[model samples]
Target: MSRLPDAPPPGAILEAAVYVSDLDAAEAFYGELLGLPRLMRVPGRHVFYRVGATILLVFDPEGTTVPTSDPAIPVPPHGARGEGHVCFAATDAEITAIRARLAAAGVEAEADFRWPNGARSLYVRDPSGNSVEFAERALWG
Candidate 1:
C-alpha cells in the first residue's frame, strides 16, 4: 500500500460543501436564517454563501449525479449515520444569541452540553438532516 504525505502546514478552512434537496430553500435558510451572505450563485445548480471567513457551498443532490463507488474511493448513501457533525465556534454570548436566532427562525435545537475541556456546545439539524453544532470555549484569552 502506498501512503500520501500529510496535509501541509495548517491554514484556514476555506469552504464546506453541503448537498441540499432544494437549492433555493437551502440558500434561503443559510442566507436568511443563519445570516450568511450569498457569495455566488451558479444558476440552478449551486449557491455559495460567505459564512464569517469560510464559504458554504450548497448543491442540489438530485441535479448532480455522484458515483456510488470506486476502487480507490468510498461513498456513503445520500444520508448516512456515523458521519461527523460540523461545528461552528463562537463565544458564549454568541452561542446564546444563535440559539435564540434559531428559535426565532422556527428551527429546533438540542440541549447544550459542557465538555470536560470546558467547552459548551449545542446541536441542530438542517433541512436536509445534516447535523450542525455550535460550540464555545469557557475561557478566552
Candidate 2:
C-alpha cells in the first residue's frame, strides 16, 4: 500500500458515484428533488451534479460496465450492482428543511435520530433505493 511513500493525502473528495437502475430516475431524485445543480448529462449513461465542491456521479449500471466508444477519454469500465449509500453534510436547520421538502414530495425519511455526540441524521431512499442521508456537520467532528 506504500506505492508512493511521499505522496500527500488528497485535499478533498472530488466526486462520489452510485450506480442506479435508470438515469432519469437518478435525475429526478438528485437533480429535481434534492435540488442539486446538474453539471452534465450523458444520456443512458450517467449524470453529474454539484454538491458544494464535490460532484455526485449518478451512473447507470447497464452502461458503466461497458467500454466507452470515445478514444480520447478511455475511462475504464466499472460499475456496481444493487443499492449504495451517500451522506451529505448539512446543518441542523438545513436537515429540518430537507425533511420538510421530502415530506412535501411524499418521500418519507426512513430514519431520523440523534447520535451520542448530539448530532442528528436523517435518512431516506431515492427512487433507485439508494440510502441518502443528511447529517449535521458535528456528526463527523
Candidate 3:
C-alpha cells in the first residue's frame, strides 16, 4: 500500500512520555540519577525533564487518565497500563560514564551490548518498570 497522500511533513520528536505508578521514585531515578535538568513538575501527577532538545515526560497513570478542570492546556486524557520504553542518545564516552554511574547506584544493566552496526546500547529499568535505553546515534545510522 502506498503512503497516505497529502500527509504533512513532520519534524523531530518534541517530547516523549512514559507512565509511572509513583512520581517520587520516577523523579529520583530520572532527575537525580540521570542528571537531566528538571523542567517542571506537578506533584502526584507528572514530572518533566529536559533531554537535549526534547522533553521527557514522566506521568502517573492514575492522575493523567482523568480529565483536568483547567481549559488553558487541555491535553487529552491518556495513559498506558503496562511498561513503556524510551531511548536516549549517547556517545561512546557518555556511555562509559553512564555505566559507572549506574554501577555506583547499584543498578544493573538488564542488557548491554554492541549492535551489528557496532553501536553500543545500555538498557535498564526505572522503579516504574519502564525500559530505558541509551545508544549511540550510529545504532540507527
TM-score of each candidate structure, all chains considered together: 0.73, 0.94, 0.93
Expressed as tens digits, the lDDT of each residue in 20-123 for candidate 3 is: 99898899899999999999999878999999999999999998888988999898998888999999999989988998898899888999899999999999
Q: How do these models rank on TM-score, best leading?
A: 2, 3, 1
State candidate 3's TM-score. Answer: 0.93
- Each model's total of backbone clashes: 0, 0, 0
Q: What tens digits encode model 2's per-residue C-alpha lDDT throughout 7-62? A: 88899889999989988878998999999999999888899999998999999998
Candidate 3 RMSD computed on C-alpha atoms after optimal superposition onto the true structure: 2.1
Error of 1 at 38 (Å): 0.4
On the 0 to 100 scale, the lDDT of residue 32 in model 1 is: 82
Query: How would you order the candidates by lDDT, starting with the best?
Result: 2, 3, 1
Candidate lDDT scores, in order, read 0.73, 0.93, 0.93
lDDT of 1 by residue, 53-84 (tens): 88877777654455445657555435223323
Name the weakest run of 10 consecutive residues (lDDT summed) in model 2. Answer: 1-10
